[model samples]
Target: MDQKTNTVASILFMVTGMATVGVIDNFITYIAVEVSLWQFHFLRSMIAVPAIVGFGLLAGWTLRPLRLWPVLGRNMFLSGAMFVYFGCLGFFPISAVAAGLFTAPVLVMFIDAVWSRRRIGPIRLATACLGFLGTLLVLKPDVGGLGWANLIPVSAGLMYAFGNVATRKWCEGESAVALLWSYMFLMLIFGALGVIYLHVFPGDPSSYLTRGWVWPSASVWMWIAIQAVFSLIGIGFIMKAYLIGEVTYVSIFEYSMLIFASATAWMLFGDRLGALGFVGIGVIIVTGIVIAVRSNAADN
Candidate 1:
């Protein structure tokens, strides 16, 4: 595809993928009430991994990584990020979690600057500060009485930034399918370990994160299947978007998830944000766009 066509198609794919993810993730709140976060990951991966392999085979894509250790390292970071991200979904609104996860770009800028000994220019430095301020607004630390739980999603973003850096630095020749599979495999392992740990020394049954495996109700199974299928669809489109479009240009559209998720959550669950929260989200989105635009200019 030409650059123009690629850009347009990528935007469509990204927006659609984000919308799909936003809608499906809201279901996690319902799923969390019935099962542990570990069980959700375990069951979802059980359904998703084989389907990924089947699709890869049909597409004739190479599912093997060019370098195993780097792929595994990347997987470790990405899967850990997802673990935190989804775990927050059970306890926090999707918008807050999305805001926190989207902070990855800012974190990436800082990480790259530190690792490369590059000076952060005034514009980038200002952008980073604005992003941090926006995050505080969205999270509203004072509203809920600040606690460690509030920082969980930001931790996810930090880990996700590391995963992104690893992908660029170490997994250069890896296929998307290979990376996806490794990520899912590690998530499966993490899920299994959590389940085992909880079973051996069980915690509060009412707590989603601490609870052990329970025999899933039929409705819980339904939601798990929905999450598995829809998440794969979303990830596939997102992968395609990055493959065909310039990363800097395409990544900006990812901010659409904030809009999509927030809107869907309000519609589905009446999850309302105050005026300040909306402003914060806007600040973060604009700052992210500025960062992407500057990064693109520097690369060119």
Candidate 2:
């Protein structure tokens, strides 16, 4: 593929991957029972392992054994982010939880500047402020209620931003497949621990595994399988996009996942947003994309 075609293809791939994440997340939510992150993850790896290995064979990436220390470090933070973010989903709406986690870009821009020992300019600060304002709209934190649920996704976002910084600095030498392999293994470890913790520590743990493990019908399997396939391809696309596009611009499209998720909710689940929520999400998305475009323009 020509460079331009390659760039567009990469962008599309990232968009598809991110968008698929929302569907998988929301669809799982619709399953009428909260899935244990541990069991879900264990199953995810079981399915993803074969698919990823096959993709590697076709792509001709060498199967390299991961270096233990680095993979452990990277996967620790990555799994932490996933665990916190997904846990937030169990308490909040998928799109709302996603918006809260979207704070990663704001965190990234500042974290990057701080790590590089550069001062953030006023304009960037203002844009971040606007974005936060929009996030609050979506979160609508009711201090008196279980509204603190917003914090879960926000914490997840912070960890994710830190992980992104580490990615640029530490994982530069690693192959994309290698990164995925190591992350998968780490995630498996994380899942096992989570399951053990839930089952052993919680007094009413049987209620969990009993919640919804009923035989999944053909439709659930079909959707889940499609989600998995798209996700794997999407991961490759995102890695390629990060290689070609500036990191910040590439990250901006991450917000599109919110838009896609909300739209899917409306169509598939008849989710409706109040006036303020809709307006707020619109502002949040536009601001994010604008920030990305501005950053790209500045780079060019």
TM-score of each: 0.84, 0.79
TM-score of 1: 0.84
Estimate every model's Cα lDDT from 0 to 1: 0.77, 0.64
User: Taking the tens digit of each residue's C-alpha lDDT, what string does model 1 give over 1-300?
Assistant: 676677778778877887898788878987999999999999999999898889999999999889999889978888889899999988877766876787776676677668667776877678677776776666544445456876788899889877766766677666777777667878888999999999999999999999977999899999999988899888767656655654444555666676667677778788776787688779868876676556535532
- Alpha-carbon RMSD of each model: 3.2, 3.9
After best superposition, candidate 1 residue 190: deviation in angstroms? 1.4
| Model 2 Cα lDDT, one tens digit per residue, 33-137 | 435556666556667767787788899995464455665676677778887776666556776677668888778777778877867666666767677666556
Most TM-score-accurate candidate? 1
Identify the runs in model 2 with alpha carbons over 4 angstroms from their true place: 1-13, 31-35, 62-68, 135-148, 196-203, 206-227, 296-300
Q: In angstroms, how far off is 262's CA in candidate 2? A: 0.7
